[model samples]
Target: MKSRGLLSVLTFSEKRENLLFLLLNEPKTIAEIKGYLNVSTPEIFPRIKEMETKNLIYKENKYYALTPIGKVVAKFFQPLVNTLHVIEENEEFWKEHNIEAIPQCFLERIDELGNCRFIENRLEEMYEPHTEFFENISKSELVMGVAPVFNPAYPAFFLQLALHKVHVSLILTKNVFEKVKNEYRDDLQRFLECNNTSLYVLDDISLAFVVTDIFLSLSLFYKNGIFDAQRDLISFDESALKWGEELFNYYKEHSKEIKSL
Candidate 1:
């Protein structure tokens, strides 16, 4: 294939397409071509002359035939026509389902094409979606949040955090403290101790949040289960880290003296 360098030179119209198809069966004079298409000679002659001028066709005797470039152009455009035909064939079927979004795109493929898989979650599921409202926590130097103590998946995320060596201070509620004491406290405490991670016993605090120097990821729990409050994690870019630091500082100042659990 010759590279035309990102531009198309082909121009098309209904008349040209019809003439091209007719010529494909075998070349014929203008009179014969016009008669075959059920059109008068005057209507077909101008189109043939224009196609010849565009190098889409060439005249030999009184017959017109596709130029080499025109054949290549036709082949190149066939895929697009086939795709349109598919859409046309399914148009009624899609209309019946009331589906507004087309399924032709490859969003997940685009995301996974690079070295890492890019994951995205909905804003409604996050603790805060407003970029401006979370500005303070988005810039923190450190974060201390209360943990739910009962969530199974919470441990998985906590393990990931420990693996990453991200700094996050956790405060476990007394209700959580008692449960852990009765069951998983020893293992949980050992894990925390290994990381030199800080933990506070459940006191006045409400929920759990993991905070790093620049961002916060929060989770809360009620009788049902855990909900994300400070839902999305933010990065500690220079400016964002500065803002998050202020928020962390404010919380640190206001929080009651935290003792080791």
Candidate 2:
């Protein structure tokens, strides 16, 4: 059989792949590697040997470390693995939703939403604010959101957050803004008057999401163009929060700030 290439060397075995990842941060002695991976010397040594032969790793002074090339590969490889896991973990969600609303830049970094979980409302709770989302934002120091759809309760609820001195920033679609201005004028005015609050209006958007200091909550329209009110993707990971903030900022930059009405 022809010798397998570097791709196979890197990907063919889970042990080898994990060993490379373990070495990414720093070199490790065999004892450290064995303990970290919970594997015996006999099982791990052969994988390490194979990687060493491929020049993906090197040993010196009783420690194993990735070579320069290995470092580069791992740097790129980790993100690929993370991205795949993120999509595969929520394959039905990704397939059924309208992700085209997400900007290309943010879509590329989707892996930053590490270990996100779905929040699916029960049948009786359909169209209600997600309880977990509400509870998290209530305790957060800062809250930012994009609202492409309007809920009757949101105007008063978000206004209450602003009044409590939570830093609140929101980008609303023009239609939603109009609804708030016409029917919730009092709440809207008070929200705009708060020193810690800001509001902006943009053209129609296809998704709604919120990013707070503690979490991110994302809702998308279905492929059939109806908003999916029953499910949301939520994450408490720091990287996910940062990613969500960037996404909010991207929309904020293009929106027109509303000072009154």
Candidate 3:
């Protein structure tokens, strides 16, 4: 019952939540709250009073500040709010994919993907590689990836990038590596020969993602274990790029480096 009441007060209104957020950073007087919230005294005072009654905040001199309990609540609310934003931003995409394929740590930090662009294939382009994705990655100087699926276009394009001195570090599923070793042996050999290239083979993985110097793109298997070639979640933000690097390393450490063949 106590927890229920606190949760209700914490989530009661956007204004209340905003007030808590404002106090999380610094103490503010009524005038400052009014200026930031753009609400009149009649509107702001009642919300402040409710928070005070809950002991979520306290007044010191002319300023309002979060109590220690309020600070702890503020800490709790941020990740919850950020997780909601990430799920809300791409509602359908998140709903249909196997989100569990993403490791827990990365999923918790989904907020890093705050600036993501969720691109679904057009009906006419349903089977084609995303032109914008290719164009954006074309300008990259370094690319790190984990792939569980293979496309016919990848071999030639990745080799072209490597030939032009772009650093390429990739981890491929055992099956995909076998397919490449047998079918595209020349291109695979040439790609591995580059001083700037590194390759690895790892199985028992279910997601494909790439992080480049310019952007990050993620692809995941359907809940039924099939890859969806139609949609891509891409982000150009530096934070997402950092997150992707960590994700790549997580799998890379579990993989076998292919110095050749």
Candidate 4:
């Protein structure tokens, strides 16, 4: 038999999707669905009938819940819905930034960036270190990151952070690593000498992101592959911090430790 057409199965209505998601947890009575959805029977019944006809749900006594097929379908649809919500939450950030710079595997799990916020330096402060960024990372006991580009302030600030006894780990792209070694050898030396710091070098990387115990900040390349220095997607949410740490670890695992530089 031919598979249900994509539009036909999933595109019935937004209410259907919401109902499917709601039922994934537990069966609910019509009154419960109506109360949770905040809609009257006239607004919700037709969608429920349609879902029932599609075998997406079943009614027993007074409660409605997903069928086995519906649960599987919801398992797949939830991610697509969640990923879209995340990207759209910071629509322009994801739109203008070169999201392709994010690796394919992590990009697929982009929804893991729960409740991220777009943060930008003011025009007058465009080239300066972000105050909020400094504030958040400064207070963390452990900080880790990947940097694909150079920053004049970072060498000093990160060294200071390490000196303050914060454990610091970083993965830098080759060019960025060399740039720091050539331009800020003293700071690089200080960082290396500090017991709290470790550095690694990757031949190439496509994006910049930092994760600390407190927060995560990510900056992406522009669509043409040029780095964007002015804006970052920042988040203090625990899930986002976990996601960012995984991203940092991905590059670190693929990189070589830089004991000298």
RMSD per model, one decimal: 19.1, 1.7, 2.6, 2.7
Best by TM-score: 2
Candidate with better lDDT, 1 vs 2: 2
Ranking by TM-score: 2, 3, 4, 1
Q: How many backbone clashes does candidate 2 have?
A: 0
Put down candidate 4 lDDT per residue, 1-261, tens digits, no spaces.
224653365656788788889999999999999998988999999988878887889999988999998898899888888888898888998888788778899888888887788788988887777889988888899999898888898999899899999999999999999899999999999899988899999999888888999999999898987888889888888888888988888888899997775
Give the residue spans of candidate 2 off by over 4 A: 1-4
**Local error of candidate 1 at residue 24 (angstroms):** 68
Model 3 clash tally, residue pairs: 0
lDDT of each: 0.49, 0.92, 0.89, 0.87
For residues 39-155, could you state the per-residue lDDT of candidate 2 as single tens digits?
999999999998898888999999999999889889988898889889999999999999998998999999999999788999888789989988998999999999998899899
Q: Name model 4 segments beyond 4 Å from true.
A: 1-9, 236-239
Question: Between 2 and 3, whose lDDT is larger?
Answer: 2
TM-scores of the candidates in the order shown: 0.33, 0.96, 0.85, 0.85
Cα lDDT of candidate 2 equals: 0.92
Better of 1 and 3 by TM-score: 3
